[model samples]
Structure formats: structure tokens, C-alpha cells
Target: MEMDVVAASELQRGGWDVVVIGSGFGSLFFLHSYLKRHPDHRILVLEWGASHSRQWQVDHQTNSAVDYQTTISNHGEKDWNFSIGLGGGTNCWQGMTARMHPHDFELKSRYGVGLDWPISYDDIAEYYDLAETVMNVAGAPDAGKVFPRSAPFPQQQHHLSRTERLIKADRPDTFFAAPQAKLTSNVGTRGACCNNGTCSLCPTGARFYAIEDMADIWEAPNLTICTGARVREIDFSGPIAKAVLFESEGREYRAEADLIVLGANGIHSPFILQQSGILGGDPGSYLGEKMLTFVEIMLDGMDHFDGGTATTGFELSYIDGEFRSRHGAVQYWTNNSFLWGGLRLDPPGRHRQVFPIGITVEDLLYKENAVVDTGNKYPVIEHSGFSDYAMKGLDFAISKIPEVFSSLPIESVELRRVLPTADHIHGSLRMGDDPTTSVVDSSQLHHHLRNLLVVGTSVFPTTSWAVPSLTCAAMSLKVGATI
Candidate 1:
């Protein structure tokens, strides 16, 4: 299993029903669904990083479960950390899951801003159901009118932290609900979530870590997973992606497959496609553009509340297109008063300190805004100009800060640093019916390459208030069904 391809004597050949490029949530979900539905199918999953849960080693250049001193990406010996391991980023993600609002699917037509998704919320609602079931999501029923669903949530939602309750009591206008990912009870093979506070690295393994979930599916006779396999390029015999080229233990190898899926996150997905020449005139043209990272504003202040996690509750009043509905919905994340609540405070004659309050809004970015350029094999971001409207929306988000946490007796609340924040990158290969404006179609089939499908958030036209894992999982389910 730990064969080095670059050092192999013969060009190895293996066949599979499907070969997945990355092991992120998108990849895991799709593979799970595929194996579940078509148990006869053969799945070969190649992860570039080492197997974190079962490995004694960890990567140094890039922080992966794999214990490697060098970086996995082609950009250089050091650059970004795209998890090439078994569980992918989910191994280290804060398990915050929410579905994209209906409007997010129709961003272009609704606001005349970006391109529209070929599919709509109606098309993928069931997949959301599947995601919730698998993750054992502890979210309340659909009290929010915006997310209209025919069926009640499978399980009851979670309870708000004590800090969240206080914040809501102070800011009645802002509603707070227990986030949906960490569970109040167990769903299936996954265990009940013990509020370890370290949900990002839930050592107890109770939280819905996708790697753990998928590992169970691997027990099925048809599925096979290879860790420490870093995919360098997606090989295509014409438009159809024939094989995925990857490296393991200082050597390169290729896994030929009938179908291929790219679940690499926003940063690395485009990097792989560009390296493979998929962006030239057809799918490639729209491959690396139309990028959207939610504009995140981190405001800090002092509060007496317990310093726990930063994000606990959220407000959707801004999302239904209310006060600034015309501008689109804004999301709010609550910080632990001691932690997030005090990130901005000038400590009592204090030394410097920083806390990440977790509340966030899903604001839009200009489509033609930026590109990921690898210079000297190092990822260099070339950001485009921010639209005036985007700036105004950001300002609006800032102006309404006091409405959420009035208790934070702020000595002085100042902007820390406005930056692009997205756990999931989207829109490089947007989905649409036409080839001119998009890269993939409703089925996630690339517009130009009929047989090639680009999975994950790369198909999103705009960022949404919801975390993308659920949405991306739902979309991949739909894609797998068609394939």
C-alpha cells in the first residue's frame, strides 16, 4: 500500500468504478453515497496526506494527518495546507453545518450580481436530509420561514450555550439557536457529541467527523481507500477524465477509472484543474474565475460572560432580506464573552491578546475579484477590486454590531482586519445550463467535458450564510445519482 510510484519499475495500472481526487467532506460524502447506492461499484480513494487517525507521523510543511516534512502541493516545499490525508479538512473543521438559503441558489437572477445555479434548493432538499441523517445534526425545526421544508428535522436541535442565552437576552432583536452539527444524541454509528469545546479537534470522536463516518463505509466490500497519495493532475483522454495522477512516498502513480470526481477545496481544486489544462477555452475559461469568499469582519470587545467558544448563536433577520433585505442576508456569530467577546478590548493595562468570536455573515464578493496564481510554485493570490456595493454591505454589517452584543462594555470597538473568510471555496467552476457563463451543468457534468464532473463548492456562484459542507454533500449526492 505504501508503494512509491516515481520509484516503481513498471507503470502500475489499476481499475476502479470511480476514483476520487481529494478526501475532503465532498469526496467522502460522494463516495459513501456511491457505495451505498451501488454496492457493486468499486471505489478507489487516493488521499495525498498520511492517515492521521492511524498514523504515528504528521506533515510539517503542511499540517496534515500525514507525518511528512515536505508540502504536498506543487507550488513548493512550503505553501498552503490542502489535507491529503484520509479524513481531509473535516478532521480539523469546526462542525458547523447549515443549508444554503434558497436565494443563494439564484443569486444572479435575484440580485443581478453573479451567475445562477442550474439547479435550485428544491432539487437538492433531499440530499440535505441525507446529510443531516448522516451527521446526526441537532438543529431545531424549521422555525425560520426562509428555510421551508415539508418534513420536520430528523432529530431535535441542540441547546444554546449559557453565553448565547445571555447575548440573546441582551440583544432581543438577534435570535440565537443551538448550532446544528454537534448532536444532542447519537444518529447511527456516530456517537453523541460531548461538548468538549474543542469541536474542531473532537478528541472524543463523538462529533460527526466525516473520516470516521466514511471509514465505516469502507468496511463495505466494494470500497478501497489509499492514504498518503497526493494527486498532482487529473488525466483526461479527451474531455473525459480518464485517470488521476498522484504521489505516495516520493513516487507518482495513476489510478484509471470510469469516473473521476474533484473534491479538492476552493484553493487546491483550481490549482489541479489549471495544472491539467482544463481552463483553456471551454471548462477551463471559467475554471479559475468567479471566486467568492464571504467578507468576514472580526470585532472584539470586553465582556463578563464566560470565555468559551466564539460562535454559539446566529441571527437570520438579516437573511430574509429584511431591514437590508434588498442588500441580501447577513449572518451573525456569537463569541464567548471572555473569548470572542473580549477579542477587541484594550485589556486592563493589559498585554496584547486576540480572541476569535465565532459569529459570521454570508456576504457576497465580486465574481471577477481574484485568481489563485502559483508563482515560483508558491500560491500567490491576485485579488481584484472590491465592488462599492460589497464595501457598503460590509459597512452595514459593522454599523449594526452594537445590536447583537450591547453587554460587551466596549472601551473602543475598532475593525481588526477585513479579510476573505470561507472554509469552503466556491464558483471557480460555476454551474449553469450554458457553457458561456458556467463550467458544470445541473448534474455537475462539466459543460465542455461531457463525461467529466467537478464536485464540491467549485460549482457555487455565490457564498451563502450556511456552512458549505451540507450543501456540497447534497450537491455531490445529486451528482452521484446522475452518474
Candidate 2:
């Protein structure tokens, strides 16, 4: 099918009803749901990176880098590993689609740490159902109770790999098939997962990426997508965003819209607000503050090197319960595929049995940790050290390594500390009930600017110990319906 995307030069000279920046899951899902209600409304989508097809992504490994100027301090000189293409990080995500635990929404009320979300799990439960159906989620029916789903998954669970089965056989309650966005059977134009084990670059399009899923939306008569349009700033007139200034092909252009939505991930969204001078004083203080991410811990013990998706099963018993009182929640999963190709295992025959169990600890939000623009060429991400709660959680998770892996028959389990990378960067433009504490309201709209809305994980008040794409999609859908 031909995509109905145009260049900035070909854009029509008229104001759009809505201008959505970025083509990630949040933006696409909002457009998909919003257009269904109001099909004749004029909508324009602005994407910074150029589009890439599945064949092209496979041929290129989907690693073609873009030259956007952004940096991370206290970690590295380079910027966070964020995708800029049409689908953004969905092009490279692991496809885990777990929902945030109910306790995650009430962090402050339940655990006396972090801030509680303006909305609860019950508020977004229907949207999660819609997002799961649209993404064709596949998972075991047993996970329904633990995940608190409103409806059954659209697709049946994929078969567990031998490694996952082995782990589950030993510890039944500790492991279950992970809820993933990848399809198990053919759905519309997308095919079933071929189990090539390269989900980051799936050639078959079995995985659900927003760029591929938004093809029908792009073809809609009411929508227009402009690729390679890098938004520099939102020209605000008083409290409303009057126009979006962008650069394409080394030339600058402007697009006017009555309503503007920022779906440009966590980092860039605040950076854009700072560039536009909208974030200052109280809002600016909280703009890039309270950043959160997980500390990755790798374990060696299972045999999971066969052909399968990136992750088939996960452990969630430790994420909540009495653990939150002392430390944050901890989540672990079995890595089904060996993406690191060049690692040598101890002994010759141990390579097949040396699988990795990935552990992720929930991060507490801190006001001091922030992304700052020092009037330099690039934005500086000044992140402070992890909070005491987060450290306690990491330490607790580390202490449980021996007992958790004792069920499986393995030689030894090792812990390796990798360089910290910002995988799930959130809370730069967080949403809350109070304008003094958050940048946006519960509906994800700016408190001062009524017509400007911020979607995606950037608006998350707290980062739960789960993959955030599903939650982001749900929030976008809720906001779309409200609009």
C-alpha cells in the first residue's frame, strides 16, 4: 500500500485542527483512535526522522543513526539511545507489553515514596484493553488475574521456548509467558512471528511497530504525514501554541494548528519546551527533573539460545507486596535470544546452557536529577545518583539472585554491571493534579496552555517496574477519547 506522506514543501497553506509531533506509539494510537471518532477533522503528523520499511530495516539492522544534538552527563558524552524514525523506539523495542501494577499508580499513598499518578489503573483499564487489541497482544490466560486485564488478549499466547519451560517447570509461580505486542498468528497485513530471534530487526513485520500499524491512518483522507520535519520550537502566543517551527532540507517552515500535541519522547519534549521558553519558573524547575530508569542486572544460568523471540517469559512476584516498604519493586525476565554475538562462555560445551536472566529495579523520582540546557550546543542531562530507595531495591534484588536461580541446575550465576543507559527515560514533562508539581494535568495537557498536550512516557509521574509502551499507548488513547 502506498503511504500518503508529503514533504514540507508540498504542505497545504491552511491551519490543521490538530498537529501531532513524532510518530511513535503514543502519537499513532492517538491519531488512530481520534480519527475514528472524527474522521473529517484535519490532522497533520510531523516526524523528525525519515521513514524505513520492514525490508529496509532488516537490510540495515535498523541502526541507521540520526545526527540530533543531545548529550548525557555523569553517564557518557553521547545522548541516550532513542530512535528518531517514524515509529521511534518501537522499531527496536523488545515488544514486552505488561501493564503497571495497581500499586504503581499509588506509590505515595501506598509506600510513602515518589508521587502518585493523577489517574489510577481503573481509569486507564479500558484504554489498555483497546491498546492490547490494536497491538494484537499475545499472552497466557493465567496472566489475566495478575495483570488485572479488563478483557482477554486478542491473540493466543506463543509457545514457550525450551529454556522458558525448564525455568517454569522448576518455579511455576515465579515465571509466566510474557505479554508481548508481537502477533502469534497472521493479523491483517502483518504476518505471524517467524521466530528468527532478531526482534529488534524483524524482517517479517510480525512485531507491531507504530510506523507499520499507522499505514492505514496515513492513507486516511483526513490525515497527512510529513517526514523529515524536525520541529525546533512551538511558537506560543500567550497560553496557546499558535504554530510549529520546523526545519526540513536545511530550510525552515511553519505549520499552524489550533491544537498541538507533543509525542516526542521524554528528553526531546522538555528540550522543545525549554527552547520555546514555555518551561520556566516552577514548571521549568520540574521540566527535566524527577527522571527515572532501571538498573539492568544480567544473570547466567539457563539454556535459552535456540530460535525464538527476544523474551518469552518474565518473573513478577517481587515487583510488589511487602518489598515496596523497604525498597522499590524488582522485575526479572528470561532473555530467550542471545543478541550479544561475540561473548565467549566458560568451558567449551557451556555455551548452550549459559542463558541470561535480566533483572530491572524500579527507580525513585528525584527533583535533583534532571536534563538541563546550559546554553551549549547540546542539551546536558545532569542526572544525580540513584535514590536510597532505589539503591535498597537494587541491593535487595541482588541478594535474591542465589535463591532465585537455585531451582535450575547450572554451574554458577554471575552478575555483571554494564554501563548505565537511559532505556525508559520518563518524567521530564510529567502529569499530575497540581501544576506546581507537574508540567501537565491528568489529561496530559499543559496546565497553562489549554491547547497543548503532551503524550508518551514523558508525562508519567512515576516510573513503574514494567515496560512503559503499553501504558503510554493507553494514556494516549484516553487523552484522544477525551479530546
Which candidate tops lDDT?
2
Show model 2 residue runs off by greater than 4 Å. 63-65, 68-79, 169-171, 280-308, 341-345
RMSD of each candidate relative to the true structure: 5.5, 3.1
Task: List runs of model 1 lying over 4 Å from the truth.
Answer: 1-14, 54-82, 142-144, 161-163, 166-174, 186-196, 280-310, 322-328, 337-359, 363-380, 385-388, 403-420
lDDT at 192, model 2? 85
lDDT for each candidate structure: 0.58, 0.75
Q: Which residue pairs collide in model 2, if any?
A: none
Error of 1 at 52 (Å): 0.8
Model 2 compared with the native: what TM-score? 0.91
For residues 403-457, write the lDDT of model 2, one tens digit per residue: 6655566555455543255367678888888877788988888988989988888
* Deviation (Å) of 62 in candidate 1: 9.8
Full-model lDDT, candidate 2 = 0.75
